[model samples]
Target: MKILGFRGNVDPASYTLSDALPNFGRASGDRSHAHSGSTAKGRDGADVPIAPLVTIAIPTFNRAELVEKCVRSAMAQTYPKLEILVSDNASTDGTVEMLRAIDDDRLRILTSEENIGAIGNFNKCIDEARGDYFVLAADDNYYRPDFVSKCVRLIEDEPGLPIVIAAYDVLVVDEFSKDDRRTVPARLSKKLSTGIWQGTDILQEYLHGRISAQLLSSLVRTDILRRNGGYSPHPCASDEATWIPLLMEGRAGFVDEPCATYMVLRESLTEGFTADKRLGDLREVLDELSAVTAKKVSDPAMRERIQQLLNRYLAYMAAVNLVIYRRGGASLSQAVQKLWGWRTVLAKCSVTDFLSTWRLRSIVRILSPQPLARWMAKNGFDQWV
Candidate 1:
């Protein structure tokens, strides 16, 4: 009976949403005549099949304002069969109160007794999901209406594919302009022109430091996820660093349409987690991933790609530490620590590649980006970088 209002409309529930929302009734009608059961309307007012029950699982800890928009986005999906699950990590805020007031039967709220960390909360969401496929919806980001439907079609069409990655628009909500949005379509061009990378092209790209897209861009197959032992337990890039290798089991397909929007936060772990001591944690995880991928994958090509990716990550880590030193985030002593640690990994890699990255970084530091980009372009280091 309590149909709360969202951002834009309380004017009139369009015919489709009106029927879908629980206990729908006209403003003037008798209060007793509310429609309760699921009845989805098509574009021309015909009833289409209700979508397969989709569980959009969100892991939350505070950020009440952001979670509301995320829930609204899930509710707005054109697909009829959706169940929104919010797994709260025991926040002291009024997050629970805010959710309790929402009158939708489709939305389910799950909570932890105490504050579990984000990784624990996420794993709980996965364990609780009943949908044939599970979508990891972050508290801070949201999806377009077609997200579920498009992904469902992709997975169903090629049921064997372990992951269906939809193109997503990166929304740098804080500082970046809308013009700065990047598209993350699976690149066939890279597959061909780059030649067969490591073992699998996906692994190769990941090894090459190219799999930096947001987690929201991916809708993972539940079975494949479970088989791989879920989220990475050791506290470093768990969302991304874990999922990329799991998806590497088979080819990753990309949908052309933008399904989700990632709202970049200044304090987002992907950015700040690489600071201070956390960088060491991330480096350890990357190292573990490299070792595991190499041992597990049967294909020699994949192992090579995984090793190359590990090498590239070592190089990137060195570059990042150098930047930290230049920007005063790290002391000369800390920079020395990083250089000593990472240079060892670099030493294991091909000398040409190591020298190329070192030369490129020095060039960038000396000259402006324009000249650096031009010079790198002149050499083939542009693509490798």
Candidate 2:
């Protein structure tokens, strides 16, 4: 239970829960670089309160060491009013003991009697959260100390904004070698500038791969998240299902600074996914998004725009699946079957739509045989194609 970025070594046994929350007074190293106060300037240059309670819900299973780091990061935040909710999904790996060792009043621990799936654990976290703002923090990922403070500031600056997303760094951890780690700039970090963006614009950016669907990167309004029904039950891509609808409902603010770390573990869920499974899960996600859009959006033109964006996204996903299948050494027939399965769902898509949605490279990939595509990929020509 070693905490990172605390001023000094703290013995958990010496403190009671009441005094565990740190006093983050005006410290020079704080990223916000400003003291908490009642008044701040809105995006429109009007005055607004800067104080709000933020709850970070961390749903974890079977990753004790990583979960401790995640909890330590949350406990080290500079924000004065914050709570860290750690929902354990019946982990047998001593995760509960590790959590109990920490003496923090701001932390609320909830453990399920049996192993609920990841989505169920997430929903439990959401149901238990009691803060003005909510964020879903993954067990393997951690945040910067100023992450909460900075996001709160942005939301306060824009009174009506439902969400605030910040730039983040990617931390790649090797599975075999625990010591091996690398940090890289997350995708679209360069493209994201500090400002308030329209909800539709944010959705468009997300569809274009200019933004990530990680809930850890965004602080959302609690009521809005509850209203949207938290995360979806899809086997995969549920985060997209939860986030897209919320983004469509209200505007979001962006912060340029990298305020969190998204950890990519070799044995993590994303890395273990197979091409077929990924595509199948994505199909579910797409269907859910379409239904949500049609029911929420009344304007026919706007609905059409969203549909077009989703269609393009589906095409892009198909291209990714082709690459994965080829790289994984699947047979030509197997790859074609997977491609055809996806194609059948998108049967109404025209050549013009496909070409426009993914550009010529996707068309080339989709049309080429598996062996040829693999050769092209091996020779590095597939990158440009």
Candidate 3:
């Protein structure tokens, strides 16, 4: 597989916080209206005031074009005291030049002399943030103009809410035809009422796929995030690692509106993963989460339940990997051999569990000839694999 966009070889010591400090300049707009002592109704019907500052951190790699759109979207936020931070992960794609061209005073550009990988860049964003609330915006994603305003209102209304997970729309740009684009609301399990929820409740919802863990969809409290440690170093599931722990520590607010757009790039890190590699990444994520849960939860029964949940999740992922391998042209025997040897996958379930967890049709597809499986996928009859 091709390397992820931000994982280029570069010395870690080359970039420091001093290199990324922003020069303060007056932004063009009169943001006074944004800070107008606005108050919104809380979950308990009491008036709550908005926080003073909101920071949006965009950690970008090499996507110059997409990064510009992301920055523009962030700059368009209606929130009054907003700061737009662009942490360039030492891009050779003219991303720095593009950011420099933007005249908005609210926009701050931070340059790294060398690539710091995605996780490092993300943590750098957190370290440099100076707002009461923060949003880790992806370079490839764009937000609606009111995204921040709405999220801020939610958090402000629900005092003590550490994070607010908003709904987002998926923007799928056709690989072959860039003009043929489709925008669809992300399919969430259920529409939750706007309110503050317990950390365990949200975690349960996330584990059940009722809520999304997308970093772009979340608005976090800066201090809470720092106390828990920013994003994890795990390449694939850092979002999960960070958000789950933070949610466990405090209450979370929910916003039902689809406020951001996640662009599905063909060559992006997520799409580039092979079935085996994807499964491995999931295993690493589960292991990290399991360790965190075990350390934090004291009840033996709750710990056992979490373990069972982990095993079930692993089973689901293994089944998905089976489908992915088949879609990647792996023969039945090759797929089985590769999956069977994975220790984490094996530990999740026994042979009987694996057989019973997946449906007969799914197994048939996994075992089908490569040509047939490819034809089915091409015809759009099999979309999930």
Top-TM-score structure, candidate number: 3
Off by over 4 Å in 2: 1-50, 175-184, 189-192, 269-274, 298-300, 356-385
Give the whole-model CA lDDT for all candidates, comma-separated: 0.53, 0.64, 0.63
lDDT of 2 by residue, 193-289 (tens): 7777776776776676565435667888776787776666655455566666766665677776677876655334123356566656667777778
Tell me which of candidates 1 and 2 scores higher on lDDT. 2
Give me the runs in candidate 3 sitting further than 4 Å from their true place. 1-52, 175-184, 269-277, 298-302, 350-385
The TM-score that candidate 3 achieves is 0.77
What's the C-alpha lDDT at position 168 in model 3?
72
Write one digit per residue (lDDT tens) for candidate 1, span 1-385.
0001110100000000000121111112111211233434422243322333567888788878889899999988886667688988787788989998988987889877776666666667666766545688778678889888776665444443455555454443322323433222232223423111222555454445333333455666554565666655645445455566655564555554557765543223123333434445556766777777766678897577667766665555455445433333344556567666665445655665556445454435323344453354334343343
Ranking of models by TM-score: 3, 2, 1
- Each candidate structure's TM-score, on Cα atoms with residue i matched to residue i, is 0.67, 0.75, 0.77
Task: Give candidate 2's error at residue 186 in angstroms.
Answer: 1.8
lDDT of 3 by residue, 98-173 (tens): 9999999888888888777666777787888777678988787789898888877767666546788776765545
Write down the worst ten-residue block by lDDT for model 1.
10-19
Between candidates 1 and 2, name the one with more favorable TM-score: 2
Regarding TM-score, does 1 or 3 come out ahead? 3
Residue 353 in candidate 1, Cα distance off native in Å: 3.8
